[model samples]
Target: MTDLDTPAAAPPRAGALRHAAPALLGYAGVRALGLITLALWSAANGKSAHTLLTARWDSLWYTRVAAFGYGWEVRLPNGDVHSNLAFFPLLPWLERLVAALSPLSYADAGLLVGTLASPAAAWGIFAVADHVYGRRAGVCAALVWAVLPVGIVQSMAYSESLFTALAAWSLYAVLAGRWLTAGLLASLAGLTRPVGAAVVAALWVAAITSFVRERSTPPARGAFGWRRALGMLLAPLGAAGYVLWVGHRTGRGPLGYLDVQGQWGNGFDGGYAFARFVGDKFTSFPSALAGVGLTVGVALVIWLYVSCVRQGQPLPLLVYSGIVTALALCASGYFGSKPRLLLPAFPLLLPLALALARLRTSRSAAILGAVAAASAVYGAFWLNGSGPP
Candidate 1:
């Protein structure tokens, strides 16, 4: 049989699914424990767990968009305007579709989408890790992600899970040499969140590197030369299109999106505002310790990213992780949301995942179980408290 007709030459996707099943099941268990904990805690506190997941904070904004298309705004006492246009449309659009097809409310539909997308995100994370490292490391990586402090956001009516799913699968496509699939998923990711720019940048960097490398070596037949170029061309369209549409809608030309973000006090200032915020936290002894903790956390994230580079990770993974880290750290507003924003940068967990994979299986499971229990309690506490902004 010719190359195209060779059915058994490659491992089937079913095999991959089988391999990833354990990781997915573990992730689901951790998430389920978190939900159950939240429910119990909410009952004690006289708050509904369902309300916590589907009706508060960003979830409310998303459902508003789904129920009534855009144009909603709030004028703060300080004269700042918070516009619904700041949110990307994909999650709310999905919410609307789900609500239209079923008897659920828009909020419930959003919760459903997030619930379903979380496992897909875990699967995508597993695929990327398995391709780069091995099955053991892949499972470890997914478990690590599931037990992250801010992981509860993945189960809420939020865009983080959906965005992570798209970003992970897009990166996997890049690694698998499926350029068009990468570009299309990257486009959808762009439609999901502003951080989708990271995925596009990764694809562009990889495509450019491929082109430069190919220029030195003679191209072979059936090489994905022009198709890779097409993927590069397609990568940025979704984000650019949305920005331009916002400009047209707001009549502010091409910078309209920036204006919307600006109203919310979000801008890139090279982490200056963040540093100042950290500094301001040093007024008292306890607050100073908090500042120190923040500083160490930021330093650790940067160090891990540098380790990824030194370890010679795939170019797309490095680029995507770097951009995600940079954007999460440098944004001037919503200091509390940085960790949650960094949830999609799963590549940062690879070094830890590798270390865990080297341990005895029982030891690794013990460590993961402890972390998962702590995470479940923290998630419940977090949602019951201030929660993500």
Candidate 2:
């Protein structure tokens, strides 16, 4: 056979297997080790590992929503309504679906979804990295995400992993010019979290940039025309519709979601609130020293964004990453829980992934192993119990 026909006729199975093996192996190792550490930590703390990892804090809320279906509300001392409507809904919906088919309870179903979604999110991140950089960079990006201290949360009964999976794939779809798919995924991502704004913003920016570029380059075959652009416009429909419907039910406007978050002591204030809080922390002696330490930490986040921009990352990534970072930092609510809230912004892992990619494979694996172990242990406390307030 001719070389062209020979290569084309080669078995696709081996190639598919080869491509899938590394991602599967790497993600399995990360999740297995993380779960082990979480279990051991729960044992040490005299808590049931199942309950600790699957049924606490926000996870409990999600489980309750899935099992009971909203309508349960309590008037808090602060006069706020604590109801399932306060949550964005996608996670609970998944949990309910899983529970319906599986032997597992709603809480366990939530856990299962989170566990599966973690590796899926990692895979999506790898695809984005590979597309943006190269295969080596993709491996490194997945490794960084796999071993992140807060990544364990992604494996618990939380929406972060699911949201990340949706957002990453949505970003990849946008980059690939699959407008309808991107729009649908973006809508689902928005249904997962308030920060799904990042996904919507990324798609809008990508669409606008593509329109501008098309003005210069001659129209390519099969390119998204205005019709595709209109589909992209329809993406925010899911998120907006849900929020507005909830608001209408509650006799609140489209902005009612923000008002609800405010009841929980959160809102977006353009980083001014965070600045004032940091300033006040410096007014006391010992607290001033602590503020200095915290400033160093914030400086690292600033440096990461600066470095990413300097490296000339893709516009969609830069825009999405910037939105996530700004939303997390400038959010005027629950300042103490900012880290947890921002955990799904996997783009922040990119710089660190690039750095890790420079190391030998074995060395990098060892380092990741150690960090994953530690993160899993720390995650037990962080996910199950109350974090610093």
Candidate 3:
């Protein structure tokens, strides 16, 4: 294997959460700014920010699944069918659990889950970044993730934050050589979103590499090599199980999930559809500016992934981020949701984080402060307008 594929050595696990506290606090501040901005904007427009965050867009679909199990669907005027099954089960399951345990409604429970999970995701990002680079970079990485333009989605009743929290800890587990833990988290991630496959892939790659490196070595004093094998076995279960169940319910066999996504006009076309999407935007002057922005955004994503590879990131991170990037960019539908979809691919931000960590603390704070303000305004503008698709 190339040096780029080398496993990043795990750090001492002691005081993990205690060490992440600073990043968590910073993340909370950024999110608070976003929520405040959105709330003020909504009030000026005579709208309820609570309703916007708790009962709109994809949030409604998840709430439906939580309140009424999954046989529900909507048939659009153009003969397109949108299935609730297209929404994964994990978030709704948690929402149901929260509702049953408390007085909150399903949607409110979803909002509660997302609000709490964002910090978990932030800390997980800090943990993985801290493990590879150092405490400073890890702190920067977590804050950078919170300041993303779609950062507000992390606070909404969506599944992005929850899935990110699971995926992050799963990757951290893989980095820490806790194979069974990684696999278990990967399974839960799969139940959260289709992109959960990325976590599963990371676990498999790391485990296979370990096996190849020590094929004949005796298990160490406490090493249960079987745990590695078990992790590999468990990683795919969540996604596979959900997909197969969809097949059974729809009577379309193993390909049923594809049919469901197809009905929603979603599919992987290797970015051909997306390329044409960007090209078509250039037909008008105003649209052309958006086209240029899209070009730069896509370019930035590619550059970051390449930088990650050149930086010699651990094999698990490379595998996980690569799949997540390809899936987000190559989807044939929901072009506007690309940024939100890319939310969990935090490893791509490492190269930027490391650069930021080297700057003077005051300078870094100023830069991120400015960016966080911009993100706050944009997030408010977005949710008040059409919001992310």
By lDDT, who's the top model here?
3
Model 1 per-residue lDDT tens digits across residues 1-389: 11111111336789878989999999999999889999999999999999999988889999999999889999999999999999999999999999999999999999999999999999999988988898999999999999998888999999999999999998887877677888899999999999999999998887777677666665573377767877887888888888889999999989999999999999999999999999999988989998999999999999999889987889889999999999999999999899999999999999989989999999999999999889989989998997657
TM-score of 3: 0.96
> What local lDDT does model 2 show for residue 141?
84
After superposition, candidate 2 runs with Cα above 4 Å error: 1-17, 220-222, 279-293, 381-385
Cα deviation of 154 in candidate 2 (Å)?
0.9
Q: Any runs in candidate 1 off by more than 4 Å, and if so which? A: 1-10
Candidate 3 residue lDDT tens string, 236-284: 9999999999999999999999999999999999999999999999999
Candidate 1 local accuracy as lDDT? Answer: 0.90
* TM-scores vs. true structure, each candidate: 0.96, 0.90, 0.96
Ranking by lDDT: 3, 1, 2
Worst 10 residues of 2 by lDDT: 1-10
Q: lDDT tens digits, residues 82-108, model 2?
A: 676778889999999998998989999
Question: How many times do residue backbones clash in model 1?
Answer: 0
Provide the global lDDT of candidate 3 against the true structure: 0.92
All models: lDDT? 0.90, 0.77, 0.92
* Per-prediction backbone clash count: 0, 1, 0
Off by over 4 Å in 3: 1-14, 216-222
Candidate 2: RMSD over Cα atoms? 4.6
> Which lDDT value does model 2 have at 181?
74
- Report model 1's TM-score to 2 decimal places: 0.96
